[model samples]
Target chain A: MAENREFFNRRLHSLLGVFPIGLFLMQHLVVNHFATYSPEAFNNAAHFMENLPLRVFLEFVLIYIPLLFHAVYGVYIAFTAKNNLRRYGFFRNWMFMLQRATGIITLIFIVWHVWETRLAHAIYGTEVNFDMMATILESTFMFWFYVVGVVAAVFHFANGLWSFFVTWGITVTPRSQKVLTYATLGIFIIFTYMGIASLIAFAY
Target chain B: MAEDHKTIRMIVQRQDEPEAQPYEEEFEIPYRKNMNVISALMEIRRNPVNAKGEQTTPVYWDMGCLEEVCGACSMVINGKAMQSCTALIDQLEQPVRLEPMKTFPVMRDLAVDRSRMFDSLKKVKAWVPIDGTYDLGEGPRMPESKRQWAYELSKCMTCGVCLEACPNVNSNSDFIGPAALSQVRLFNSHPTGSYHKAERMDALLDDGGLQNCGNSQNCVQACPKGIPLTTSIAALNREATLHSFKSFFGSDYHH
Candidate 1:
């Protein structure tokens, strides 16, 4: 029984990465891209999300719960696994290390980001609109931090999707894995571009 | 002209006993043509002298089949997990560093307890089952194409090098590592072994099985036999998925 749970836990970790977390990131990038369109559109989208019926419950189930599980389990995996980049400097080995590193950075950024935005808005009932994001991004340090955090998050999700395929038995053959590698790289480029564009929208 | 003299320097990580802390010891041996790491160690063992010209206890290590076949001589040589018998001194940089493979507990000097690997092999049942001691009439023949990969898989000598190179297999984690996972593919492919396929697949679905693999791809590169460990793992993942589906519905579902 214990053994089976461990097996399921690992698969659950991979599944959560693609479903709610990866999907959430993609949805977030698209919604934030509304800022590039107009501040009014961005505010409307944010307002819609914030005012949904059972909004707190939805966030707890769809976002916070899954994110907490993924992040905590990710940290456990990173701590337990050894990094062999110095001896075996294979491309995949380096990717494995980078995945863990980005996970750590993304966790820190997400915690701070959530505390700064969502929690503060919830507790103090602060207006979370276009002006608030623009104000936050106006600071040089905060802007750079968001850029780094976005880049790390994008890479983690993209590279994680590639590993997800292998982990879940979706890409078995070497040829298929190679194709997925290119697809994953394509994802990284596109999502990163979207993330950077969204951040740039705040800068102006 | 004075005859030119040459010597090789090696820094060996040593432990007095299993419970003792590890320490580094330097030894210098007269250079010999085509000397392997094991040969250099033998020279040091014979002399039992430190580079500072002080008397010391003979260094201990494990070896068998002086060739790489037995897998008993695996250790971390110059930051790489490999057979000491195959690691040539000429190819290695000066001050070659030797340490026991950290994936397994250090027994002493350069030897380690590889019982974990053997235990994993048992977990996966990496063998063909037979009815009795008497010879069973000719077993089914394997097709040449399938036989080819099976032959490749059979080359695993239970060397802990793959375990060493793997990031997932470590002290804190209960991961069984790549060797046993590859063995699952090998044994399950056998005609008679296939009879117990469900059992093996179930074992793989257990904890410390295929799920522990993080897809680092180091095991394939670090394997001295080049056993294609990751490919086997990916294949096993597919099989396990199918097995789970079959279990969920019925065995006849796949049939």
Candidate 2:
């Protein structure tokens, strides 16, 4: 029973990283990318997402719950993981270390992000619009912080897809793994561009 | 450091006791045309003298057959975990460095206690279970294709090189490593060994089992036998996932 519990939990952790969490990252980046057009365009897009049916419930169940578990369990995994980059300096070994590093980074970034936008919206009734983000990013420190945070989050998800495939028995062959490495690197670049570009549009 | 044309310079990492601090002793030997690392170690043993010409205790290393088989000659050759018996001197860059694999407890100099791997074999029951007391004739026949694939897996000699290269198998983590995991896939596929398939899968599902694999993939590259370790691990991952589902929903769902 104990064995099965752990097996199920670890699989759940791996699954949650890709599903709503990864999918949500892509959607969130797209929503923010609207700022590249104009303030009104960004405001309209954010407003539409905010007014969705059962928005609060969906966020709580899908996003918050899974994020909480992934963060807590992921933190445990990160701290416990023994990184051996010195002895084994292979590409995948470096990725193993970076994966843990980025998991922690993404956690901190998400917490601060949620506190700034979502919690502020609830507490002060501040409108979650283009101006709010622009004002936040106006600070040089905050601008860089969001930039690093977005990049880290995107990297964690993209590189994690490679592990996801191998872990779940999807990419068994070395050739498949090699192919997926390039594919994930492409994902990282494309998503990172969308994310950083959105942040730049807001900041400047 | 200029290399002498006729001699090979080698640095050996030596530990006097299992719990003692390790130190390096350099030796310059008259290089033969076709000598390997094991033969070099034998030369050092014959002289038992360091580069300073000071007599030292004979360096300890385990070896058998003077070939890659028997898996006894596995050590870190020039910082790479591999069979020292087959490490030809001409192929290695000097000064050649030899060290005991850190994945296991060093019993002396180069000899390490590979009990963890042996224990994992027992945990997964990497064997064909049958009563030897009675005449059990004509075991279940396996096809030539299956035999060829199984023979590839059977080539593993528990060399410990895979564990040495695996970052996931370290001091803090108790990951069973890739060798035993591959053995599980090997045995589980056997005709008669399939009876205890659930038992082996359960062992892999336990702590320090499949969940601990970070999939850094160094094991496949470091394996001396060219075993498809990552492929076996990935296949087991699929099997483990299905095993959990079957257990959770009850076996009746399979029909």
Candidate 3:
């Protein structure tokens, strides 16, 4: 009885990850990638997102609630997870450890990130545009912090996608699983590049 | 064939009592061609002498059928859990290390209590339910194609290898492990077993059930029977997911 709840909660965690959480991450990176153009271009893109109708309500329903659940349940999972990579050092074994590790890293990063940007917008009325990001990344230490945070976030998402397919029964066979591994690796590389490139544009 | 190469050095992990601390004992055996790990152990048993010029109690292990089918003689040989019956001396590295599977309680040296796996099997009801009282009308037949793959799952000998390989099934956690999870899929897929599929699924939905899998994927690779364990897990994941939805939003479904 209670186990079913656990099962549902776990599946919900997995589903929420790829659906709203993972989707929002990709969208966020693409929007930030606009920085590669010019300040006006990036500002225009950021402003366009900010001006969306019912933005606050949509953010709560689609982003904050789901992200909160994923993060909370993810922490429970990470705390309870036991790693055995020393004896069973298989590829997937390493991946399992990394997933948990990056989840923690991503959670810390997201909390600080929300405080710096979105929450700043709400509390201090700071504009979430190019200048704000430029100042955030201007510091050498903060720039490296963003680099670690961004890479961890992307890796967590990409690896989480592979298990998402399995958890949802999308790719069940070895051949299908192998194919998705390569596909997810591509996703990791592409997302990581976009995230780091945008940061570089802001810093330099 | 080379001269002066007729010996095999082995380091065996020994525990005198169930609660005793495990210790190592080295033995030098007269190696022979086609010698499997079991035969080597038997030699050591016949003469329980240690390399330090001391007499000791014979090492104890579990074995039957002397074939992989029985799955009784499983141990961690050279850091990998496998059937000692087929572990040929020639294939193993010198000074071969042997240890009991740590996932379960070490009953004695190189033999741990596998009752945990059996308990899991019992919990999941890994059997088709049928009463002899009445003829349940012709059960639905399965396709030959599906049977072909299902046969792979039936090969599980319950040797406890999968659990040994899984990090999730340790002293602290009651994960039920991949062995029983795969068994649930096997029985549930059967025409007769499908009669009680809901019951088995409920058992799986309980704590220490399917949600414990972290997808380490070592079970499928470690299974001596070559069972597609991860595939079974994935299929069950889908089944559990649908079951959750039905239980939540659909008709009041109950056991």
Better of 2 and 3 by TM-score: 2
lDDT score at residue B110, model 3, on the 0-100 scale: 87
Which docking class does model 1 fall in?
medium
**TM-score versus the correct structure, for each prediction:** 0.94, 0.94, 0.93
Question: Per-residue CA lDDT of candidate 1, range A40-123, in tens?
Answer: 999888777778899889888889999999999999998988898999999999999999999999999999999999989989
Error of 1 at B228 (Å): 0.5
Lowest lDDT 10-residue stretch of candidate 2 chain B: B246-255
Cα lDDT of model 1 by residue, B1-255, tens digit = 221278899999999999999999999898888999999999998899999999998888999999899899999999999999999999999899999997888989999999999999999899998877897877899999999979999999999898999998987889999999999999999998887888898888888889999999999999999898988988888887778768766765342
DockQ of each: 0.73, 0.67, 0.57
CAPRI rating of model 2: medium
Docking class of 3: medium
Residues A64-177, model 3: lDDT tens digits: 999999999999888776677877899998999999999999999999999999999999999888999999999999999999999999999999999999997888888998
Tens digits of per-residue lDDT, candidate 2, B3-35, equal: 436898999999999999999999988888889
Alpha-carbon shift of residue B114 in model 2 (angstroms) = 0.4
List the global CA lDDT of all models. Answer: 0.91, 0.90, 0.90
